[model samples]
Target: MNRKKSLQIFIQSPDLHQIRHESVTGDQTLADLKRSLFPESNHRSSFYFTLHGKPLPDDTPLSIPQIAPLSTLVLQSRLRGGGGDGGATGAESRDCYLKMYSEKKPDKVDPNEQRLSKWQNCALSNEPLREPCVIDKLGNIFNKEALVEALLGKKLPKEFGYIKGLKDMITIRLSSVPRAEDGAKFQCPISGLELNGKYRFFALRNCGHVLSAKALKEVRSSSCLVCHEDYGEEDKVVINGNEDEVAALRERMEMEKTRVREGKKNKKVKGESLEGSRLSGTKHVMAAVEKASAKVEVNGKVSNGGGAAKRFKAIDVAPAHATKEVYASIFTSSRKSDFKETYSCRSLPLGRN
Candidate 1:
């Protein structure tokens, strides 16, 4: 009976400047919980209650979906104009719906949803982020093993062809936030904001400083907010960016690596010179070339009457599975041919025609 109620939620103040965590069990009523949480204002009726822009009645019990654990409850005064959480009356104008009923806040983002996308899941495989993770030039994180598997299977999407190989990306070290029952796994080191989708975050390329994007705008410095080290615009990679940002990042990566590709192309040897050919590579093909040249040499000396003709030894080119005799039989002169060898008439004078 003494244990704390596990169904927890966050309560945002009127100014949106502070958030307080509150928990309730199934047995507790909403009025009792709210009254206990906000005791200072007894006459104000504590304004109205809201859960994600939708109005909630004072008596709404803790066991319903609206009161689910980890959901946020915002407390706003009538003056702020986001007051009505319950649906307006039939006579109420469209402006009432736009101001109170609309869930579309100008820059509203679900922290839980963003957390899953940015920290728990990967971009390449669309799977859970596991050990051996990697980050790209755009600060997008992925499971390294998944990327390797996709690369080997040739299953990578055509749009991601910018990843020429492992060289295009680097292994990134993530500073994991300690786990809590309702805590985010990653966050901005400087702002202390959770890396949930509610706020934009970026990682520094040189030093791996992951922080909120607001820090960059406010500081407006060319150095990291956390490390205070010098960095260029190219070094700051936005996390979980939109399509245009991703496309720009991919282009920048390819453009920067162009020099590496050109250098490799320039370093390759064009062709070996005649004098250089004999000095390099295997001798397996060399034996075949030598045998052919020996045939020409033998015929030339005999015509010139230089001396006894030199004998050319046939090189063994048979596969390991073949015997020398069987292999040689394939090319021996014993094979029958349709044409006969012709000799000069003067040279054959002593022989019968």
Candidate 2:
């Protein structure tokens, strides 16, 4: 039986700036080993591993004769513009001169370039070159796919519950450019790995700032990074929102409208009730006034001093025959001709003759 063996390898870049130690089995391929060490370098076509200044074929197994345990490997990108003898062509040498000249030219570089570079990174995670990007109103860009996942209840690094809806988000389109003859690509402001749709992205509804969904999960507050707008769970919306999400947003809006309408209706009802109470109070006041006026007319005259008291005493002492005679004398005509005319008219009225 062949025993499985593991070897620890020290991997470094050509500039020796980044070094990582990884343990690999004898059966593992060099490509797999490189992927484990530097995930971002996988897209390069001409990158290779070197042991003691010698290139190793990608298919060479770790158990090869030239490689041993604890071996040191350097990963390097191939130089472009080589001649038949592997020497630099005249045109290539001139190109190098031109590149050197451009680097030394201070006028070509902008002073605010560093600040601008920071803007290209994900504001939440500070990771550069996140794709499927969305910008908020304030021009901050974030990864949209990660944000959608977060909205769907996936765990995220930053808490971006502040975005209210997807209507406030817009997706950003990135253009790619070739970097070298090895087909290496360069994208401004983003130096991270290619967006493989594995990670999710999000944007702030108010500010349009974009970030990774993972980074948004780490947010501790509801404030936007760029615009500083306060947001809630409803404020963090999905970018390029699907129909169901849009419908849900519309439904939420409708619910809010209904609540507002109900509030107004309740206010109107309360106002009308108050008005009714006021009108009822006014009616009661008017009725009391009328009652007081009638009482004054009937009883106030009697209650006043001696004249009214004297009159009342006379009426009480007077006989009923005298009272009737006084009323008849005042109402009946005194003239004889007038009495005769009234009697004749009454006598003829009974038979329509």
Candidate 3:
């Protein structure tokens, strides 16, 4: 056999703190690279290789242009389940082999164009479906957490206008799954870790997409990742959620309700105050008109000093209809103050009578 040409490479752990140098044949596959780097460990399947923040395909040859001499590569381990003995538990070991072996990027599929079934991987995160998973009215299945975060204001490339709030969505329980055994190895699309109580999961009330609590905490916006649905404060619900989180969600919902109720109450009070002021202003105007009318009647009797004046006053003031007409004329007049000024000047001349 001909001598194999070897390439020098630098390898580092996921944290980038542990670095090592190794020599390997140009034709060696990624699996072979992992074995060489982690010779003492039997759980090599838990680790994956990455180059420049992107995962490397296991089938990719070391001689590829991207793998230059002394090039640095990241060897990351999937976040494992906790153990009772302070080491990886038996479940962790069993789930290690289930880790994604390929280097394909998550969210490679377009959610708008593709219609994924409930049993298939998520179109956005590429993780297996789990409890609290929901199929939207459009027949698309997604994790609740992803939907909640998307609704909570996380920016997404696509637009989902059909979803409005959690009340419109339906929740899926563990018993409803057609094949419960198939989802035992479900992992988070973002963290690539097995879903468990420690990591926790959340679902969106609107789209019913599930996501890990850790992933939701990192969300800065209200848009869902899979469907791009925007979620409001009331649209998030815990899927097999922690007690602390559940209580907090309830408290937040109550607070929001109280705030909305108080806002409406304050608005009603302001409206009533405005109506009361209008009524008081109308009464003031009526009082001013009545005072002016009484003065007009007294002037007519005093200035004339005859039975004819008394008769004219009785015709003008005794009938309510005639008095109302006089009031209307004074108020509708272009110069409202002119009537008051005219009455004041006439009253001074009437003093002699």
Whose TM-score is greatest here? 1
CA lDDT, every model vs. true structure: 0.64, 0.54, 0.58
Instruction: Give per-model CA RMSD.
Output: 14.4, 23.1, 21.1
Q: What are the runs in model 1 whose C-alpha is more than 4 Å off? A: 1-115, 219-229, 264-353
**Which lDDT tens digits does candidate 3 get at residues 327-352?**
55554442234223463463323445
Q: Write the per-residue lDDT of candidate 1 for residues 196-295, one digit (tens) a residue.
A: 5777777777776676888778779888776778989778787778889888887887787897787766665433353366565447467656555444
List, residue by residue over 89-137, the lDDT tens digit for candidate 2: 6644544554464358521222233233334445443345467776543
Pairs of residues at least 3 apart in sequence or in different chains that clash in candidate 1? 55-85, 55-86
Query: What TM-score do all the candidates reach, one by one?
Result: 0.40, 0.29, 0.29
- Better model by lDDT: candidate 2 vs candidate 3: 3
- Runs in model 2 deviating more than 4 A are 1-215, 264-272, 295-353
